[model samples]
Target chain A: MFQSDEDRILTLITRKLMGEATSSELEELSLLIADNPSYEILIQSLTHIWNTSPARDEDFLEATFLAHIDRMKKNGCDFDTYEQEIEAKRPWYSSRKLLVPVFSLLAVVAAFFFWPRQASVNTPVIIAEKEIKNEISTRNGNRTRIQLLDGSTVWLNAGSKLDYGKDFGGAKREVYLTGEAFFDVAKNPEKPFIIHTNAIDVKVIGTQFNVRCYPTDKMVETSLIKGSVEVLVKNRGEKWVLRPNEKLLVENISYQPLKKERNVAEPVRARKVFVAIKPLTYQNNDSVSVEAAWVKNWLSFKDESFAEVAQKMERWFDVEFEFRNESVKELSMYGTFTSESLQQALEALEFSFGFKYAIQGKKVIIY
Target chain B: MAAYKKLFHCLFPSIQNFAFSIVKSRQLAEEIASDVLMEVWVRRLKLMEVANLRLYLFTSAKNASLKKLKQENRFSPFSLDELQVEFISDYGNPEEILNGSELEKKVQEAINELPTRCKIIYKLAKEDKLRYSEIAELLEISVKTIDNQLVIANKKIISAIKYFVRKKS
Candidate 1:
């Protein structure tokens, strides 16, 4: 197609507007525009239009990015692992500054655990042999189900930890728990699965059970769903056998020992470790027990006080709650929440309890 | 990590818009954009060897969008003439320009009436700030074609302004 000079000038001008024109092309454009002076206004208008930027909603963009991150996580892309892998791949000299303190802290912990005694000085050397301990933990608002080497499956609730040695499932099946978990022990007559907690130990041959031993809770609870298990209270040195649908509650001795030390002046009241056996809580014909509902992604509470439910909600939603009015904490609440967002949950609670609450970032203030 | 986030915020919308031009679905476009950006993170070390990261990302988005269309059984080998490209421009204060809102409206209408290929080229050049060669590489066309299409777009808008100028005189 034969192009006119007018069309040629516009092409060069467009290139010039986009900063794509060379110095020679620029000179050619300027000369062509000078010859057709009437094109000056059109060129100026085009430049003005090109310079104007489209309106952007930064907050919307940020929200979209965060949602994208969530989708990535749901798709099994763990960014935290990638970050650690990248850090590990960095040059040693560059990583040494950050690794030094972490290594020193590990050394101190190791020394405390393996300190040599006068008679057993040689034992420290044997104990220093590397024993790989596998630890799996879940952050608040997240739950994980992991299968053990023994074919047993364990579901860890939010804000829980399950630690086991590398030799687990070989000669001994033992795990240390700091929070809540549900276990379905694989049947192994030779090895009894044992869970060690701060206040008690749960021993079972083949059973389905749930254990709740959060550090913030006042008691340790073991709820057996299908099979029998034995619960040993550490402070009381008593073993209680639990039948199916039985739940044992033992007062946490970790906090009470410190309280007893503080109140030494008082007469020694025989504070036998408070212990009780009760039936597992079931809600309105639901086969799933309230105690183990979290395994199924439901946060269930049965006639629990608002204060107790708030603690559960904190882990379930990864939020901090501040109760401004003390009376609001004592209000008995009962409900099951599965997939409601924090805002919707709060609104439902507000409608029923008539409590005023405000959510600021990750903190919820109740009055 | 901060650099990755900065890159995401800077490039996501533009990539999404480009994909939207091909897929014609906002949700699918956003998904394609996310997938493309995530690939950058996945291949961060390898991508450092790429000469033009922006062009690489745009090309990835284009391929992903076309793949998504194919998955949905809507794939037709992309023809620039068949694509519906949306061009959005912010004329800050129309009254400050020559002959005010009438000319601005005319310019907008002219942009709307532009051929699909011409509008896409114009948008990539003006809004996305892509060079002529980059646009040519992304769209799989020659730089001469881009140069001519851009002239066609500009001539249409300039004639809109000239119409108003003639009427006023």
Candidate 2:
């Protein structure tokens, strides 16, 4: 790579800031700055920026530590054993018991109120409240299994959030979902498990199914793995029962306003939703249905366009895809990726689809 | 145990921030940080054989955060590029040195606008005080890449400062 002198000086200055620059490199950097008096201010400012450290909130950290200790004790961590071990190693004069009073005082202080003092520029203050709303979320490239108090399990896919009130499983077993999740409802016929999404509300007595209702997706999908499920489209108030191994697709009517503008002549048609019931997708010789493969950690897709697959991959791998070639997005892709690195998955796609792709930092550009 | 508390005070913030970059949730990050530190105490005898305790803790934090995401059933691979790191650069002394808060805001925005990979590299090098070789090893990138990313970050900050200087003159 051809390096510019300015870039070279900046690199040397960075190395110096990180304490990685050799004496010769330091001399070279100084000489470069001396030659160009204009560079002095830049170098100084950069150095100052490098040396500057964020202010720490001692009070907040102390409160957090106290809370952490409380949680550890709740989780059955034997701090007394560790304390005895430490006491055996050290003399009584140097015992940790000396600081025990200070910690107790701090805990007393924290009990009144502990507000986060160190507020960063962009981070919003998250109030750590135990009651009110209980929310669990997973970021992209991650999945999590959550067990509710009702003995039901939910496998939350990436880029998903499940929110429930504190009264959950009390009067009604209801949850609001913003992305995709697989649910195994406990056998509670008295309390129907209901999931409220933007497009539809799924009600079930005791069943196993997957609900995908991402805000950006065109259709809300409900794939039943076993048992039965009842779905109600919010707009039309239409209800349908889903049997085992059946998938229901309901057009996301939230996008109707945008579509209404494009088809003003068919106003009645615009208000209607396209509903379809089909068998669950399965790859040849594979026991796992493609719809539920994500629960098993398999990124499976069958006859989905590259654009659609890219969206899934975005959540699956946490990388944004930019298609430079429009025609390539329409190419149909079929495969299952299990435990493959992002680069490896991309390479496999490139080989199969005959498209060139570049993996930048968190961005995958395809042509 | 006192030594352990001291270690917790020393390493908690950075580890929590590192976990926060990956999980993008404050509560989860805190849990992961606490879990990582607690593991050190639980497995102290076994961990004695491990070299580079700081790096080990960092690696543990990273894995713990990712593990929170994938859970037991999934086998998704993670890349550092996916991390949306929140770089907190101090504006206390630098504000007076840079002349005004406006320039400080500009510098802050510039730091914020740096590429995610660049931000992580710069943070690991400068804030976390990790060596270039250590950062390279942790991120699975070459030392030269870390060097280049730092330069890019410094260049961006310099340009932001230069813009303010130019506007004044």
Residue-wise C-alpha lDDT for candidate 1, range A271-302, written one tens digit per residue: 66789998787643234679998886777787
TM-score for every candidate vs. truth?
A: 0.46, 0.47
Off by over 4 Å in 2: A1-3, A87-367, B72-76, B88-90, B93-96
Query: In model 2, what are the clashing residue pairs, if there are any?
Result: none
| Alpha carbon lDDT of each predicted model | 0.75, 0.75
What CAPRI class is candidate 1?
incorrect
Query: TM-score of candidate 1's chain B against its reference?
Result: 0.92
Write model 2 residue lDDT over A154-221, tens digit each, in one string: 88889999998788878999999988999989989999999999889999999899999887677889
Q: Model 1, residue B78: what's the lDDT?
A: 81
lDDT string, candidate 2, B23-64, tens digits: 888898999999998887677655545556667788899889
Question: Which segments of model 1 are wrong by more than 4 Å?
Answer: A1-3, A82-367, B88-99
DockQ of 1: 0.16
